[model samples]
Target chain A: MIVDIHHLNFAYRDSEILKKIDFTVKPGELLAILGPNGVGKTTLLKCLNGMHRASAGTVMVEGVDILKMRPMEIATKIGYVSQKNEKARLTLFDAVLMGRKPHIRWRPSDRDLKIVEATIRHLHLQEMSLRFIDQLSGGELQKVCIARALVQEPKLLLLDEPTSALDLKNQVEIMLLLRHVVDYHHIGAIMTMHDLNKAMRYADSVLMLKDGKVFSHLHPSLVTEQMIESVYGLPVEIHNINGHPMIVPKDSTQNLCC
Target chain B: MHLHDGQIPEEYRKYIGRKFVFLLLLCVSLLIALLFSISSGAAHISLTDVVSSLIGLETSKKIEIIVWNIRLPQAISAMVAGAGLALSGAVMQSILRNPLGSPFTLGIAHAAAFGAALGVMVLGGGIMTSNSMGAVQITNPYLTTVAAFFFSIATAAVIVAIARMRGTTPEVMVLTGVALGSFFTAATMLLQFFANDVQLAAMVFWTFGDTARASWSELAVMSIVVTITGIYFFCNSWNYNAIDAGEETAKGLGVRVERVRAVGMLLASVLTATIIGFLGIIGFAGLVVPHIVRRIIGSDNRFLLPGSFIGGALMLLTSDTVARLILAPHVLPVSVLTAFIGAPVFLILILRGGRK
Candidate 1:
C-alpha cells in the first residue's frame, strides 16, 4: 500500500470537518474522492499532504505517518496540486522548476533542471515552456501545474478538484493524462473530483464522503445508484454507457422531442 | 520546442539570459548616474576629475576635498539608501502580494517620523538658537536616530504580532498597516502642534528627507545595514517567488509561508527604518521602484530583487543630482522629487493594469 489512513478526523474550531475517515491506496492506483460541495473532500486531501494537521488518526504513507513529518519531509513523499492555481508573471519553465524547492537549497542544480525539462516534455508542455503563466489557457495552465507536481518525483500525488474548472475535452484530457501518469509512474494518486462519470471512467477506486464521514469506499464498478442517491440526496440512475458506469439524474424526461 | 534529450531548452536559456542582461544594464546605469551626480555639483568638478579622484589618481587637493568629503558621501548615501528602500519594497510587495505594499504604506516611515519628532521635542536633542533666522538643529543626531529606529521597529513588531495572532493574510496586514500609519501621522501632527518654534522647525526639517544630511560615518552605517539586509533578502528570493504564486501553493512546496511572511516583513521593515532613521523618509523609491523593475524584469525575485536594488540606486542618484542642479547652490529635498516622479509613473502603471 502507498497510503493507509485509519480513523482520520479533522476539525476547525467548533465544527468537525472530517470524521473517522479511513481508506488505503495501493501503488499505481488512482482514487477519486467524490462528494458534494463543503463535504471536506478538499480538506481530506490537505490532511493527507500535511497542509492541514489531522485532529486524530494516522496517515501512513509507505509505513511512515505523514502527521509526524515536517512539511518539507512530506513534500518529498507527496506532491500536491491546489484547486486554485494563481496566475503570475512567471514563465512556465520557472514555475515548474519550483517543484524542486524542497530538494534543492540556494540554487537549482543541473540535475534539477534536467528533471524539470524531462517532466515538461513528458507532459507535452515544451511548446509553451517560455510563455508566462498568466498568458496560458486554463487547460494549458492545469497541465503546467500537473507537470510541476510530477517533477517532485513523489511516491504519492494529491490534487484538489483538479478538473472542476476545465471544459469537457480538457477534463477528459487531464483525466486520461493523470491515469497514464499514475500507471506509468507507478505512483498513488488521490484526487477530489465532482464529475462522477469521470471518476467512474478513470478511477481505480472511489471514496465518497457525506456529512464528514465516508459513505462508501469501493471500486467504481461496484458503486450502486442507491448509494449515490443516499449520499447526494438526489435520485440517480447508474447507466453503463460505452462500457463505463455513468450517473444520470433520475428526474430527467426520457423522451422530449418529436 | 522539443527538449534536447532532457536538456534545458535553448529558448528558456535565452529567456533567463535576457533578464541577466537587463540587470547588467541597471548596474551600468547606476555607475553612470553616480559619476554624473558627483561631477555636476556647484564646485564645477568634471567627470574626468571625479573618475581620477575615485581611483586615487593625482587630483588637486581642493577637488579631492570637494569630491571625497561632500559629493561622494551624499552620492553613496543615495545609492545605499535607495537600494535598501527598494529592496524592502520588493520584498514587501512579494510577501504581502500587494503592489501597494511598501514601508511607507505600511506605517514604518510615519512611525520613524513620530520617533524623530519625539526625540526633537521631548528628548532634549533639538537646539533652540537665538540667531536672526531662529535656526533649530538636531544637536544629538544619535539620540534622534536611535529613537527613530526604536519606534519604527516597535511599529514593525506590532504589525508582526498582529499577523501572528490574526494570520498573515495580505488583507489583514495591509489594513493594519494603514490604520497604524494614520495613527502615527495623527500623533506626529499632535507633537508638532505643541512644539515651540525651534523644535517645530527641527521636526519639520527632519521630515523633509535630505540625503545631504548624511555624513561619511552615517553613510558607512547605512551601507552596512543595506548590504547585510539586502543579502538576506536575496538569499530568500526563491521563497518570495513561491509566496508570489500563492500561500497555499507555497505551503505545499514546503515553504513555511507564515514564518517567511513575518520574517520578510520584519527584515524589510528594519531595512526601511535604518534608511529612514538616517535619511528621513525618502518616499516613493520604496513604493515605485519595485514596480518599475518588475515591469522591466518580470516578477522573478531572483532578478526582481537585484533589479530593483540597482534601479533604485540609479533613480535616487539621478534625482539627487537633478534636485541639486535645478536650484544651484540650494539643494531641493530628494523626497519631493521622488514623489514628483514616482506618482505619475505609478499612475501610468495602474492605468496600464500593472502588466509585466
Candidate 2:
C-alpha cells in the first residue's frame, strides 16, 4: 500500500468535518473521491497531505505516520495540486522549478533544474516553457500545474478537482494524462472529482463521501445505482457502454430541449 | 526537445540570462545616478571633481567638504532609504497578495508621522525658535526617531494580530491597514490642532520627508537596516514566490504561510519605519516602485526584490538630483518630486494593465 489512512477525524472549532475516515491506496492505483459540495472531500485530501492537521488518526505513507512529519518532509512524500491557482506572471519553467522548494535551500541545483526540464518535456510543455503562466489557456495551465506536481518525485499525488473547470476534450486529455502518469510513474493518485461518469470510467476505486463520512469505498465496477442515489440524494441510472460504467440522471434525457 | 541526461535547454538558459542582464543594467544605472546626484548640487562641482573627491585624490578642499559632508550623505541616504522602502513594499505586496500593499498604503508611514508629531508635542523634543518663519528644531532626534519607530511598529503589530485572528487573507489585512491609516492620520491632525506655532511647524515639516535631514551617522544606521532586511527578504524569496501563487498552494508546497506572512509583515514594517523615522514619510516610492519593477523584471521575487532595490535607488537618486538642480540653489522636497512623477506613471501603469 502506498497510503494507509485510518480513523481520520478533522474539525473546525466545534463542528466536525471529517469523522473516522478510513481508506488505503495501493501503488499505481487511481482513487477518485466523489461527493456533492461541502461534503469535506477537499478537506480529506488536505488532511492526507498534512496541509490540515487531523484531529485524530494515522496517515501512514509507506510505513511512517505522516502526521508526525513536518510539512517539508510530507511534501517530499506527496505532491498536491490545488483546485484554484492564481494567474501569476511567472514563466512556466520557473513555476515548475518551484516544486523543488522542499528539496532546495538557497538555489536549485543542476539535478533540480534537470528534473524540472525533464518533467516539462515529458508533459509536452517545452514549447511554451518560456511563456508566462498568466498567458496560458485553462487546459494548458492545468497541465502545467500537473507537471509541477509530477516533478516533486513524490510517492503519491493528491489533486483537488483537477478537471473541474476544463472543457470535455480537455477533461479527457487531463484524465488520460493522469492515468498514464499513475501507470508509468508507479505512484498512487487520489483526486476529488464531480463528474460521476468520468470517475467511474477512469478511477480504479471510487470513494463516495456524504455528510463528511465515507458512504462507500469500492471498485467502480462494484458501485451500484442505489449507492449513487443514496449518496447524492438524486435518482441516477447506471449504464454499461463498451465495458465502462456510465452514470446518467434518471430524467436527464427528458430535459434535453430545456 | 528530449533530455538525454538532464541537460537544461539553451533557450531556457538564455531566458534566465536575460533577467540577469536586466539586473546588471539596473546596477549600472544606479551607479551613474549616484555620480550625477553627487556632482549636481547647489555647489557647481563637475563630475570629474566629484569622482576625484570620492577617491580621495587631491581635489579642492571646498569641493571635498561639499561632496563628502553634504551631497554624499544626502545622496546615499536617498538611495538607502529608497531601497529600504521599495524592498518593504515589494515584500508587503507579496505577503499580502495585493497590488496596492505598501508602507504608505498600509498606514505604517502615517503611524510614524503621528508618532513624530507626538514626540514634538508631548515628548519635549521640539525647541521653540525665535525666527519669524516659526521653524521648530528637533532638540532630540533620537527621541523623535524612537517615537516614530514605536508607533509605526505598533500599527504593524495591530495589523498582524488582526490578520492572525481573522485569517491572513489580503482583504482582511488591507482593510485593517486602511482603517489604521485613517485613525493615525486623524490622531496626527488632532495633535497639530493643539500645538503651538513652533511645534506645529515642526510636525508639519516632518511630514514632508526630505532625505537631506539625515547626517552621516544616521545614514550609516539606515544602510545597516536596509542591508540586513534586504538579505532577509532575499533569503525568503522562495517563500514569497510560493505565497504569490496563493496561500493554500504555498502550504501544500511546505511553506508555513501564516508564519511567513506574519514575520514578513513585521520585518517589512521595521524597514519602512526605520526609513520613515529618519526621512519622514517619503510617499509613492514605497507604493509605486515595486509595481514599476514588477512590470520590467516580472514577479519572480528573487529578481523582483533586488530589482526593486536597485530600481528604487535609481529613481530616488535621480529625482533628488533633479529636485536639487531644477531650481538651482533652492531644493524642493524629495517626496514632492516622487509623487509628481509617481502618480502619473502609476495611472499609466494601471491603464496599461500593471502586471505582465
Identify the CAPRI category of the predicted complex in candidate 1.
medium
DockQ metric for all predictions: 0.51, 0.59
The DockQ of predicted model 1 stands at: 0.51
User: On a 0 to 100 scale, what is the lDDT of residue B105 in model 2?
Assistant: 83
Show pairs that collide, candidate 2.
none
For model 1, residues B135-182, the per-residue Cα lDDT tens digits are: 334788788888999999999999999988998888888888998999
Name the lDDT value of residue A94 in candidate 1: 94
DockQ of prediction 2 = 0.59
Error of 1 at A43 (Å): 1.2
Interface C-alpha RMSD, model 2: 3.2
Best candidate, TM-score: 2
What lDDT, from 0 to 1, does candidate 1 have?
Answer: 0.89
Which digits, one per residue and each the tens of the lDDT, describe model 2 over residues A129-188?
Answer: 889999999999999888878878889999999999999999999999999899988999
* Model number with the top lDDT: 2
